[model samples]
Target: MSRFFSSRYANAEPYKPGEQPKGQTVVLKLNTNENPFPPSPRAIAAAAEAAGRVNIYNDHMCRDLKAAASEYFGLPAENIMFGNGSDENLDFAIRAFADDGFPLIFPDITYSFYETLAGLHSLPQVVVPLAEDFSLRLEDYRGLKGMVLIANPNAPTGLARSRAEMEAFIAEDPERLVLVDEAYVDFGNESCVPLVSKYDNLIVTMTFSKSRSMAGARLGISFACKELIDDMEIIRNSGNPYNVNSMTSAMGAAILQDDEYTRKNCAEICRVRGWFSGELRALGFNVLDSRTNFVLARTDKIGGKELYEALKARGILIRHFNQERIKDYNRISIGTEEQMKLLLENIKEVLK
Candidate 1:
């Protein structure tokens, strides 16, 4: 152990990412919410071509990628910004708005990373309880005098708030900064990016990990008013000028332009999600109504911990939270149709 370790990191609890077990026999990985599809062909080519440019310093401004994304969203370049990944942008947004003086607010059962972000920054947090069915009540944040963060079509639960509900909330109180994390939005929900042009306090962040099938590339984008974008830029610039490296920036430009490929992949995943939900229900499991790329399911007789291990021993991996509230349920990512069929088949044996 080093005696000169930084005091700030002495008690830090870093976010625990889903396991990526290297060198082990291949398993059907459904633990992380990654797309079970290849990236756009153009993105593959762009990454290949970008390999030759690694020696040179990437454009710290990431202008071309920013312009491409701006064109895709029909927004101005000044209204857009990019980050190494959506998680990085999430952390940046938190630092930009919330601090020790003003606490951040989000659902208690939401993304586990939110809590880790609180500890990482030495900031206090207010965790509001979700409904019995894991739905967020925007009314909880209404009139609250602090920054608000929400994952739209939120993680694990895969539920979304109605657009009309959000609009009314914004109209009623437009004081505190609100950021919507749209990591899973491309699956089957409306993004709040369009709301940014009208509401100066609204910021929407999105990732290419799920829909674009670029989890390894790590690209994130956000749209907001020029003022809000400027604030985010200040944090990013002072932190990491070249957050989006050359390969990721090039691939991001290519993937954003491949709208047709993205749509086809998303439609395929949604179909699998619907079928998967019905199959689990037929097996006596209660599946949550999901609009994103995953389903939350609970067995009538099997425990989540037991089922998780049973599936893992059979070389299939799915997410299971050990918290008391959700310990009975498993958050399963919608794999490819064939992979899901295997999950259905193996689960029968595991339960028996």
Candidate 2:
């Protein structure tokens, strides 16, 4: 460790992202939950146009992007906030809303980044366990008083609660701040974004990475009441007012305006998810009923790590966590039908 390193983060365990393998390393890359399709043509054009104007500083407020997002989300511009990605918005929320007195609370097994963010901010945290079937028990969060962050259509498990259920939970405590991470909402899960207008204490964040096919662009959108957004904006401005670059802002606005493209891609991914889950189940794997573009599955024939290793050896990639509870399961992101068929063929060969 460097002598100049801060002692505050000496014990911090940073979030580990999925491995990014070179194209030649794996024929099918399905570890990270990125959209398999290309982005809308309009978004690509907008980005190209913006790239020409990069000499000028980006709009600190991201006014044009926010206006497009506002129209798309049916909210006032003041109620929306943009960040480098949803992770930044989540970090900002933790900084702006949580503390020693006001701790952060979320499911013990979901997203995993919430814990990282809590650690990074040096904030107290309360971990609530999910139900046996991996469904979130909202009742467990009723008595806790703090900022709550939930990853809707939660990672790995892909299980999700409906918007009504979320609203009911939010109504249970008006004083508590609830942050909903809807990064995978477009893939057949209901979003809590609409509730932001009705609930002042609610914050909803979405990324253009998944459904919008702009993971490379690094744009994330957040919606809340004006006051809550103002709070997050304060935290945002304190760090980097022009967090989103000019090209990204332009691309994000164009994609939002091209809602049909996003919708079509999400619908196709949902279809692929359903078919892939059925195929996995047919092959003696226990696959979760997922609402997102990924599935968590395990088979009695092989250990999770063994399966992951075997697949990687055969030029395929999937995510396997070393965490105790879910160590035996693997997360596979949905790709195109042809890619999935190739994956299935490889899995069958590996099983044999």
Candidate 3:
């Protein structure tokens, strides 16, 4: 049995994603950062129309989705690569860019997935600490001892680095590959995609899982110089010829064309994110200044784990990390206005 599994994964400490309980019917699933709203009606219709696509294998190269994304971004099709989701793109990032000798560097408190990627690949890693405000120190990234990975509008904390600040770092050291995970870019802030035309070393990864509201779709992509795209394409071809199925290609393409849908939803989320923060503050919870579809907040009165368990018992599910610094806080995703009212109502009762 030991000989059957890949040596790399035999002892790999995989990323522990949030639980999806099926046994319970009274569940308010805010544990994962998913949109409460349905995906664009157009996309759902397209997927429905593509139901018979299972009979044939998808285009190994993802032609339709590539064209849609290229048109959306106003870039050449050759410059883009799509995956089952952005995590697939990130896995490609790990395999293509850095090796075991040159490990990746990221904020210690950032997305937990980075640590899992490093461990799975046996990549050497250097974990940098964020400033007291949970914001990244852009200046600290000037001289990368190795490849640097950053999640702008970073996860859990939701703080982001500005475009001017990112451009400054790129200007300082133009040699290293700077991979920017912009999964939350549409919610707020300018994207680094435009810079990819000029900077060959810049690669940005994005997903339809966030602003596009298609987490179940598992669609991810990256933009870079043709050279980087070509390199990743080789790795992709070696592994799965059709990483994204035909039906999903049609679905992703449909969603990409509906920019209005993604924008409208993001605007709603941004508005409600602020309102939810205010409501939490009124109830004496300290919420972080969030720019994404989620908020991080803490209560001075109770332990985070206690609050988390309490919320779960009440059929409301929010996230509480067991880590030292973040354990004091809960990362809650912004749902619809009505769902949020219920979440807030339950929290008030739980606190008492």
Candidate 4:
């Protein structure tokens, strides 16, 4: 511990991201859930063009990006906000809406960042348990007074609640703030962005990292009512008005304009997910039906850590969590069909 370290963060545990092996080791990286496809050509060109103008300060408000996002999502520019990534938007929401006295509520098995965010802000938090089948029990969250955060088509498990179910929950209490993260929605799940207009307390955030294949661009969009957007903007401007850089803003807007490319890539990922899930099930793995570009599965033939190590040794990287409830499970991000086939072959050998 450094003497200069802040006392406020002394008890905080930082979030551990998926490993990115350095130095071109030629590993098939499937642990981080990145899009297997490349970014849209139009987005790439836009980024290249924007790169030439780095000497000038970027438009801190990201007006161009907001306009494109507004037209694509059918929301007004005033209702749209940009962040470095969806992580920043979620962090802004936690700061803007949550109070120290009122806890932030989320599923125990969902995105681990919620706990990290709560801890970083020194706010109280409550984790509602998922049901035995790993489905989110909406009934359990009913009547809770704290701010709510949910990852749609939730990570790890990838189980999702319908937009209608989400609406019902948001409408149940107009006073409580409800933040829905749709980072994985473009794959197959229905988005709650449209409901932002109907519910003043609702916020929906999306990232270009997953569906748009702009993980390096670090772009995220948020939709909410005008008032909420205004409040969040205060926190955003105070923290980092230029949160999104010039290249990323341009790249994100170009990606929105090239909707055809995004749609095609998402469809391909979905198709691969279906085929790969079936293959895993055939191999006696209990694979959860995933709506995201990844699957969580486990098998009796090998332990989760053992399987992860075996695959890593074979140059195929997947994710394994040490959490008690899901220690036996491994999450494999959907890659190309050929990648999945190679992974399957390695798994069969390991099992044998």
For residues 39-142, could you state the per-residue lDDT of candidate 4 as single tens digits? 99999999999999999999999999988988899888999999998999998888998987678999989898889988888888888999998998888988
Clashes in candidate 3: how many?
2
Listed per model in order, the count of residue pairs whose N, CA or C atoms clash below 3 Å is: 0, 0, 2, 0
* Candidates ranked, most accurate by lDDT first: 2, 4, 1, 3
lDDT of each: 0.87, 0.92, 0.86, 0.91
Question: What are the clashing pairs of model 2?
Answer: none
TM-score of 3: 0.97
Off by over 4 Å in 1: none
Q: Each model's TM-score?
A: 0.97, 0.98, 0.97, 0.98
The 10-residue segment of model 3 with minimum total lDDT is 19-28
Where does candidate 3 stray beyond 4 Å? Answer: 1-4
Better of 2 and 3 by lDDT: 2
Tens-digit lDDT string for candidate 2 (195-258): 8889998999999999999998899999999999999999999999989999999999999999
Query: How many backbone clashes can be found in candidate 1?
Result: 0
Task: Summarize candidate 3's per-residue lDDT along 24-57 as a digit string, tens digits.
Answer: 6655888788987888999998888878767878
